[model samples]
Target: MASEVVALVNPNTEAALPFATTLQLVVGQATEKGRKSQNEDAIGIRIPSGLALITKGVVSVISDGVSTAEGGAHASAISVSNFLADYYSTPESWGVQTSSSKVLTALNRWLYGLGQDYRDARRGFVCTFSALVFKSCSVHMLHVGDSRIYRFRHGELLQLTHDHSTNINSSNQYLTRALGMDVNLDVDYKTLSVEVDDVYLMTTDGVHDVLTEFEIHQKLTVLCQQHSTLSDDLCEQFCLMLNKKAFDLGSKDNLSSQLLSVSQLPKQAIDDVYQSLSSQPFPPPLSVGMKLDGYQVTHTLHQSQRSQVYRVVNDQGEAFCMKTPSVNYIDDAAYIERFMLESWIGQRINSTHVVKVVELQKIKSALYYVTEFLSGISLGEWLTQHKKAPVEEVLLLLKQIELGIRAFHRRETLHQDLKPDNIFITREGVVKIIDFGSCYIKGVAEISSPLTRDRILGTADYTAPEVILGYQADGRADLFSLAVIAFEMLAGQLPFKGKLEKCRTRQDYQRLDYISVHQLNPMVPEWMDNALKKALNIDPNLRQADTCELIHQLTTAKANQTVKDFVPLIARNPVRFWQVISIALFLCLVASLLNN
Candidate 1:
């Protein structure tokens, strides 16, 4: 049996968030062989020190090897090692759920494959797994098999995970769901808000099955009271004592336990974030054939006041597009912050519909990032090529864009800037959404930024009215932008002719009339126009809730169009019907005048 303790402190004196920096934790772990010939249980904790601790947070994993399986100890060790390793390497833009789940899924598949190669179904690489991740102010948990995670706070004990075991008989139980047992693995994930003084525990089945929740709580309470004040030594001793007690209770399997106490929570400080954002200076502008780091500039792909994109080739003859901050706003801290965030967001969002940001092999010169060169035409150009596209074709493209937007939404990010130019269609008919410079992340928004942006970040024609009205936009705003794009694709024009930027008030927006798509393109059905109207509603509350709803309305709109068949003639053909009525009235007046 052995016990270890690790402690951390707030390293950065300069902070970026508005709140004071206070996130701290104390951790302790212990493992015991018990009566087993060898200990097959593995436990590990990674409490990153600086920015990593703030961005990625802390990770702790505990895995229990199947006693009857061969190489179970090795399997448990690998599961913990691979999970912590891959999780940090994942893009920081990804939420904790995404990063943790992806790493676990890949780890599960590897273990299952190894088990299949062993050719022994029962004695294969199998184990139960559970993990706890403390990031920012939230604790995210991922679980599989029978390992348990528990929270003990203020005399109350809460079990955070469910066991995946089935009782086969009174004396024997089997894991219903575990890594290496199936080709496909399902992981349970959840998140909880963290507060100071909270205590969390992770235990392998060997320890948890023997020790009741009340017993564990009592042990934790005693240790906390003895310390009077929290310390790493106290936590370490408590973990060892808890594991030893479990073994004393006649636990025959390898035992492992981990304890974590929240000492502080992270807060965004304006200066700290500014310093991190402005750590690197902007690179100078480059000309064709100019060499930067190892990249040779081949062409100028794009140029804007905010950024410059260049097609570059590396020493290995691989092509990439390097985007650098525009020198025009080099001194603008807020602009630089958003520019850096654009790179981070690009790296985080993984979708074929979105552009891929490549990781450079070596540190590059200045502050810039590279991306895979996409050989495709912008949606704007595609629109010019295929004006008045069929509804089906437009729907297909819109669906792809929606998928990309949903990916952003999953990460709690909103792509505030969505327009025809931001979308691309590859030669193979693959549609992608690009340009995340104007994205808004919930986490980032919570931080106190150095600059306050009063201006809208979206294009005038495609921007939702709510944004123009100085309100915070959400996923529905992105849906509105997509709706406008869809309307342009089908009708070859915007739903409203006036500029949104010019509408400073609600009444100004209300005065702008929505033009029927059917009037622009007679091929457009009334039902389709109705769908667009709902999506393009000046009031965001009236717009479709999400892209999926909009898609459903657009696809099933034909049924609604059928209802238009029964409309009164005056309603359907008001122009022709009113013209006949006017002529008849004129003849009657003429006859009356003649008789008089």
Candidate 2:
């Protein structure tokens, strides 16, 4: 058997832009040529967005279809690639309504069924599929088998996808899973916001198996410099170089490579450069009696059950809001450790949609952190006081919330607790995300305990179905909560409102009906309603697994709506209007007197 690899990309179609579709693919023969063949694949596409109704993108795959007793390998490979090409040509909305998981599952089952009915059971044909979808500044990946995806950023090549191999006990070399191998299958999918100048490479075992990570990085550095004109040419040259190197080293396997080089520099690097030239030095620490870190503290913020928040100076110096433990977290030691972990995680995250942490300090017993002083009210409080916000405002706020959360997802972190109190709306109409004390990093092992089991960590009203049942938490759980929040934000009521503690039972949680946003606000787009329903699904597997996808959907919906959909509801709530006006008048009077 031999290894088969294919690489394809949509070339830069527009003359004004630097963006181009680049796919580098390779296929090689294995030692036991008759027993097995290499099966590697890839796909790419441009999804619809407000920025571009028709996105320009590419999809490419290299698969060594299993050699069947009847020899259907070539046919199978052609079928898979052609199907993907046709699929990518259609609008993204026309595909599976859910996430990529469902799409891939369906594709796998369909291929597996076809192979089984061919009457060539002895001849097995399976291939590892790895794909990259790039559009604008984002990249989505779908992969399986031993093929790998690597990103070269900051002058280094970092492997992005994990290999599923049967040789885990030894060389970790056998393919444990592949499309068309079985009736049931699972696929790993992820989305990343790309920065210009970041290089992405997807390759079969031929290149990765022979070269060390360091050696690969070195080659990438040299190739990046030499083949700067044509990304595809660079990848081809690199593959040829690796093959020669492997043969020289007495390697005995097929060699293949797929490389993608992004020409634009990453936004982070640009931002860093700007900051280096423009940023001022950090201001000196405040004296004990001095104020203006934003919040007015009547007393020090104190720790509670699993969290603590403090009251501190506000900009006006007459009011206050809460800050939380900078150190000595009152939560269990593990929980307390999360505070520091969150700080570290926060550094990687940057989004105006999320609550902003102002500063962090480590004092003996007074270790405390500062953040924007939210003066208006929490989403929960607003809902209680004014019912639901105007449909437009609710949707706008939800968009902001999703924007912040999507930023976190870009950094591979999840806000495990996303309830009403955690969502704050400032008096100035800014939506602020709060309480990341329970956030978790994706792909990282979480601390476990009896208390952590099936026990809910967020407010009962907004907890997802899985969390209520004591199931493990993940990005889906956060999506579920976001759905609930969206429901409450529009409907002026919790999706499931009862005794909060009693709702912890799985059955009780499952019984709640998520009020459709459209039902509450007719102006809400149907697409949004559908997306929210999918997010709030009781079956975690059925829900939107990626926050970035959800954000995209919500943003599209918001953009599709009319101006009336965003009109502020404050005018309809006399109480809120009066309060805001009264505060403003008071400030105005104080300023006038000072001037006189």
Best by TM-score: 1
List, residue by residue over 458-568, the lDDT tens digit for candidate 1. Answer: 887888888878787888999889999999999887778746558778777867778889899898778888888888877677677888888888878657676532335
For candidate 1, the 10 contiguous residues with the lowest summed lDDT are 1-10
Candidate 2 per-residue lDDT over residues 305-384, each given as its tens digit: 44446566655564334444432324233343344344445544668767665533322122234555566788777778
Predicted model with the maximum lDDT: 1
Candidate 1: regions farther than 4 A off:
1-22, 118-120, 168-170, 268-340, 343-414, 421-437, 441-480, 495-596
lDDT of 1 at 407: 87
> What lDDT score belongs to each candidate, Candidate 1 first?
0.79, 0.55
Query: 320, model 2: CA deviation in Å?
Result: 9.4
